[model samples]
Target: MVPPLALDIDGTLTTPEGTIAPRAFPLLAAWEAPVVLATGKAFPYPVALCQFVGIPERAIAENGGVALVDGHLDYAGDPERVDAAVEAFEERGGDLGWDGVDTVNRWRETEVAVSPTADEELLRDIAAEFDLAVVDSGYAYHLKSPDASKGAALTDVAETLGHDPGEFVAVGDSENDASTFAVAGESYAVANADETAKRAADRVLDRGYVDGTLDALRAIRDRAKNGE
Candidate 1:
């Protein structure tokens, strides 16, 4: 049988310009097994992606701070802790670098996302001070609870869905996806993947972006056919 799929959005499912790949929606919606959208993005983003793709609403968002399976919601991060960390970051002369209303984090429920233009080192330092974790998703820097990791969220989601976490295959392209790579039965890092993701994955695909994801899915199908 084909294993479930856990996919990262931004750089993995989208084109270089950050829009969803034209071929992605139909393929994911038609996949034989469950498809879980896993990312550092807020809850709404993945939920919407699943809806528009015509798939079940299964997602792990906010770098694992939040998970939604079917209609049930689960939360791992404490908003109070994230609020404190964001306050400390601002007090330390840190600018989130958003040009206007900071829409990047306006609807986020668990973590604070800083633009790539901000000081990553200083943000990491601030996150450490508050006992939080910082992960660079290539598109942005996320400050979140250390306990909230994609791997842990996958495990929780898998149990809730009546499957083992190891029965899922994960595809991604950033350091934030490393934890997921660790938990998945098989993991692939696209060509443009960060070094962390490359190191964590079982194989690094030759293609990048959605092309690489398509390749990974093909490989999974081949493996099932071969009884691997």
Candidate 2:
């Protein structure tokens, strides 16, 4: 049996404006393998996606910091790690912008979104100083728990399903997807992906954003079903 397929949302499976490609739905429905939506998008977002693609309710949200498994929230690992990290971030004079920590709660389970103005240099500094991972997701910077990551979340889902990470395919298109690309047996990047994402990917699709994602998903389903 093929292992599960993990996908990112914002620049991978969906357009930046949150549109799902028309062709993606049928292809996803036809595929026998579990297609896990591993995304930074919050709860109801995935609910809408499930309705769109006709896939299972399982999803990795908040950049893998939270999981919705069989219609319940599965907080990954210890809760104290998240608390300590947030406290330390605050102590260091980290300005979470206007919304403050409430913005983090909105993502569900306390994964904070740093200011969009916080660039890679600042992220690196925060990471080095706080011993926390700052995931750069284009529109926002995510201050995540130490255990939270796309790859780690994918691993958790795969293990729960009794599958090996080496057998799974991952599709994504940003800095947050770095670890995910590293872990998956196969990795793909959309045409609109950043230079770093393209470099990390095993295959870069010709299509762009939602359309590209639809094309890629169709290709994966075809290849998986027919051994093409």
List the candidate 2 regions with Cα displacement exceeding 4 Å. 1-3, 16-18, 70-73, 77-94, 98-105, 118-127
The lDDT of model 2 is 0.72
- In terms of lDDT, model 1 sits at 0.90
Please list the C-alpha lDDT of all candidates, in the order they appear. Answer: 0.90, 0.72
**Clashes in predicted model 2:** 0
Report the alpha-carbon TM-score of model 2 versus the true structure: 0.81
lDDT of 1 by residue, 120-182 (tens): 888888888888888899988988888999899999999988899999999999999999999
For residues 1-228, could you state the per-residue lDDT of candidate 2 as single tens digits? 344678888877666676666666787776687788887766567667876778888788888877765656666634455457656656666655546345535645646666675444645565666566667787577776667777887777777777777777888888777778888899888888888788989999898787777776667766666876
Location of the lowest summed lDDT over 10 successive residues in candidate 2: 98-107
Best by lDDT: 1
Per-model TM-score, in order, reads 0.96, 0.81
